[model samples]
Target: MIVMSVVGVTALAVGGGALLMTDNNASAAKETPAQQAAARAGMTVKCPDVATSLSNVPQQARPAVNNELAKMDSQVADAYQRLAEPGAKADQESVRTRVLDPLTSERRQTLDRIATEIEKVQPRPSGLDSLAACTVKQDQAAAADAQAAAPNTPAAGNTAPAAGAQGTGGQGTGAQGTGGQQQSGPQRADFVDIRKVKPNVKNPRVQGKGSKGTFSSRCGRNENKHFNSDNVIVAPGVSNGAHHMHDYVGNKKTDAFASNQVLESAGTTCTNGDRSTHYWPVLRLQDGTKEFDAGAPGGGTEGNVGRILRPTSVQLSFKGNPVSKVVEMPKFLRIITGDAKAFTNGTANANASWSCTGFENRQLKDKYPLCPKGSNVVRTFKFQSCWDGKNIDSANHRTHVAFARADGSCQQGFKAIPQLVQRITYKLAPGARNFAVDSFPEQLHKPVTDHGDFINVMSQKLMKQAVSCINSGRKCG
Candidate 1:
């Protein structure tokens, strides 16, 4: 019996030891698979969700990194070329639109959201589980306790008293509640298309009268007075039919000295629709008038444009002031193309005619010598001294300009067109009025100014002159 008991006890003890060994092996088995995989695959045991935690980095720093990456791929050459171009305004707009503005707005919104999320983690002591989970029981109990409390009962440290509590107005729960009311929105703009306006068939009346023959007030005058031959009434400040007034009424003679002849023939009417009339301070408007006053008394026939007295009864008004006596004189003659070297020395044929717009000319006389002498038309005064901005001779500046003449020939030199007559002078005699004229100013239309090569030549000359003057201790100016 004793021998049997010892053997049984030894067997029980051996079985218990084996069970303890199995428990230790089971714990090792739990960690072995992960450790083996990490070692075999050369992988790490870091958190799989690491991106989510690191994404919590301040949003502001993210854009800076993105901008840096964009710059690495940017076209540096194209940017420099654009910057080097003339009138290259700084492009700060790109920085604001592409980077700063969007980054600032998004960062503000993200910061607000982060603050709200932080508030979600209950206001607990530091080191407490920031990610702690909460069940419904705690919330429910707190709600129930709050409801069961007396109505209007002031909570601790509250300014306003509770509705049914003992506290008066002094301690009442400060309920001047500015509740979560959204801010009032701004008023939106109303948009409409202005192109919907109907075209008015009847012309607008002239309301303003400017100077002599110039109707400054366009609001009240007749529509016919303002309308051109094409029935198009030009708006104020536009270069239209009225602007050609002087061109239309230029000197009535081709020969400057001939009383019967015009500075050039009134070849054609651009618009044959209607003949415009002007209110003059001279003799009556007659079919056949002769022997008119020359107006100029002395000064060597410089201003003596031939005139004819009218047989019909006449009235006169000068500069808008009514004059008692009337003497009809032919309009001022415009010298359209004459010599840049010599103006009056220009050749004349029976059909000779010239064309230049925005040119001015004064007849050569002993007092005001024709261009290049003491005349306003001359610019080459002291050869080198004519470079002064103050000494600009605007008349002769158009001298070298080339323009098509009424005879279809090219003419050179300075020429003037009577402002009223220019409208009709350039057209073929048979059809002046209907002709469509280019409205380009003389400067834009003619190649008068030597721009490219001339600039370099003049610059080099000036530089040499400047150095010479400096070395000689003399003033270049």
Candidate 2:
């Protein structure tokens, strides 16, 4: 199941055309423990992920199908917003009638259009309509249960030592916002103290034939503030396809409409002339200050309200496979690691790893870490290290690349390639818990929804240099 968002359409209405209003604060204050527990259990829209179901879509039909997919995302987002409205949950029957039913109809139509487009050039995908229906289900119980089941004992593994004494937390007034917290998320269960997590990271042993070198690109920490809600990799040409703001580095012109030519000609932040684009959802302090996009499509209006936190450090490094020599990635190769809609879509594709600078050995896939007084929050992404050897892109944007197995080996037909490891650190006040990553309105800003997007725009010569340095077992920049 997955969901998406946009502006304006109110999916739920009280009496004909009237908006339902309630004093949530007042009513919450009077609830008993049992009632409060029930209240914390929020609901979200869950629909089958249509994009992942298709493969081998004709290039001519891709634009239309992608547009339809974006529309489906918007439909989910709009429906989720309506579900989050005050008093909407109190009337489940009304919600099902007004919101879910209409959303299903809209999605069905969009799915049909997508199939029609694909049929124009290729055989129509079967059963797309079956993916249209969505359901509203409680969102918090599963996460809470998973948290409770997490191991408490330390596991045998190597851990990255804390970098150094923590720097001051991010620059902000640390003020609480008047806009209030996101209606559905970042529950107490969503955060865990780093001290409580066991060291669970275990690296595969490097074989004798391994390419043991590393190549790093010095891309600035997005100091110029390249931000947008468009995703050129998955939803090219669709504005606000992401439904959340992303912080970008490297490529200067990377909106949804930017073609490969535009990206190649664009100025870059990388010192090595690597025009590759690296981006991820911006983390925001839940302090109620209105950001520049507060009322815009992908910000406050879409249920993402907070002060954006700039990363204290962004490290982009390409490392070699531990089992075999690596191949140079094709120019314009795009890779998306982690699922942006993992909250409702499930963790099958969720690859987000959260940890504290000092406790990098203990990675968290679902919960955000509360670092010690001197430790900073860290988000690390170790992208796919194998490619299908032919396609630079895929119908689902993931099939072209894949992660290596536990022994650091690529699958039967896939070729091992340089693995991009992105590590971003953020300094936050000790014990701070009011922080979350930007996400689709319906995703409820869950930590599991954290994801990273990358496009390899390096020139052929530069890529050759990187591969040569890696295969020769030398670290280069």
TM match of model 2 to true structure? 0.85
lDDT of each: 0.18, 0.76
What stretches of model 1 exceed 4 Å from their correct place?
A: 1-292, 298-344, 348-395, 404-477
Count backbone overlaps in model 1.
Answer: 60
| Candidate 2 local lDDT, 168-273, one digit each (tens) | 1321111222344233456556789999999999999989999999999999999998999999988899999999999999999999999999999999999999
Predicted model with the maximum lDDT: 2
TM-score, predicted candidate 1 vs. hidden true structure:
0.13
Model 1 lDDT tens row, 304-373: 1112222111111111101111111122211222111111111110111112212222211111111121
For candidate 1, the per-residue lDDT at 110 reads 39
Q: Give the Å shift of residue 216 in candidate 1.
A: 20
Where does candidate 2 have its weakest 10-residue lDDT segment? 158-167
